[model samples]
Target: MSNPAARPWRETKEGIALDVRLTPRGGRDALDGVETLADGRAVLKARVRAAPTEGEANTALIRLLAQEFGLPRSQVTLASGATARLKTIALSGNAAAIATMLETRLGAGRQTG
Candidate 1:
């Protein structure tokens, strides 16, 4: 399997509005979406699967973010849109650091929620 990294996405001051393609339960957690790069370039793609449920998908998202950023689950939080398909996740520490982590650790795999 390829490392869940390398894919790139741009970061913003108000946190990232990820173009996520969520796979509700029985899916996989990988970076799958189109996002502008930090350098203002248009790069697209990454995939993550963790069914949209009552905090289930959010939990999985936290885990994935932690794994990618090498941070603890407590560090990541769903800043907004928990019930909606499009959600906003806030990464503690540094936004740029988290963005780098996502760019590096985004690929196909099974991530439990």
Candidate 2:
């Protein structure tokens, strides 16, 4: 896992706001782990099977995150970077729980950025 102070997610009013470096058409749908970017920004590494077209990959990402976080699709929304590789995902629910879950899950799947 990356440094705790540099983790890519933060507790928001509703839940957590996550910075993700998404790879569409990534062969398989999975969260690789957490890493710090070249500029020192932390991001979660995630790959989706769906291609980046007609919002398919975005939808797939939402579904993936929702499923990963055990939240409904409605709770997981793209907060920014719709057409870019780096996306900000907003997860709505218990902020603390979601943060803990993200930390635990990402730490378990940790990988170098």
Candidate 3:
């Protein structure tokens, strides 16, 4: 069985590659299950309260990620997933160090590449 706290998602391409399990209209926007990428990327899983409509979810996602990483909202960008549960987010600056922090804090495994 998979560890409940173990994140299967990862970070790549100087960005975060996630296997998102979206729950639209959730109680609140949040980020969790941060991990490391071997290519020096920061990976994390997120949850948002906005519905998946008119880019609402996307906006919420960026806001949540920015808040989680303590970066500006513009620092987080949706690389894909205009209308999908799973999405890729690109993060900028000190990515490797951030990934290390996520891995240590969230207890998620790291990506080799």
Candidate 4:
């Protein structure tokens, strides 16, 4: 199988672009794992307890990602999909370091469809 983490994010001059699949109003806020879609695209799966109303889930997701990657909340921004389950988040930092951190935390074997 392809490395899910490798496919979900890409390095850019400013930072890294992350593809995320979010589940709002989940029991708790947490990183579930990686998920491969039917189209073979991979995304990082995360859940937030916050409801999907008035950007609450979006804010929670940003906070969670910032905390996970040790970046300031200001450094993490929603790049796309503001009101959708799939979102693209841009993190302003070293792409390589961010990728390494995510790989270490999520692991290669942890993937769900």
Worst lDDT window (10 residues) for model 2?
A: 104-113
- Misplaced by over 4 Å in model 2 are 108-111
lDDT of 3 by residue, 79-104 (tens): 77778876776666565666665555
RMSD of 3: 7.1
Instruction: Name the 10 consecutive residues with the lowest summed lDDT in model 1.
Output: 1-10
Q: Give all candidates' CA lDDT scores.
A: 0.53, 0.86, 0.62, 0.86
lDDT of 1 by residue, 36-112 (tens): 44554333333356656667776876687567557777766777666865555656666666665555555323222
lDDT of 4 by residue, 1-113 (tens): 44544467778898888899999999999987888888877889999999999999999999999898788999899999999999999988888888787677766567887
Sequence-dependent TM-score of model 1:
0.55
lDDT of 2 by residue, 27-82 (tens): 99998878788998788888999999999999999999888878899999999999
Query: Ten-residue segment with the worst summed lDDT in candidate 3?
Result: 1-10
lDDT of 4: 0.86
Of 2 and 3, the candidate ranking higher by lDDT? 2
Candidate number that wins on TM-score, 3 or 4: 4
How much is 87 displaced in model 3, in angstroms? Answer: 0.6
Error of 3 at 1 (Å): 21
Model 3 pairs whose backbones collide: none
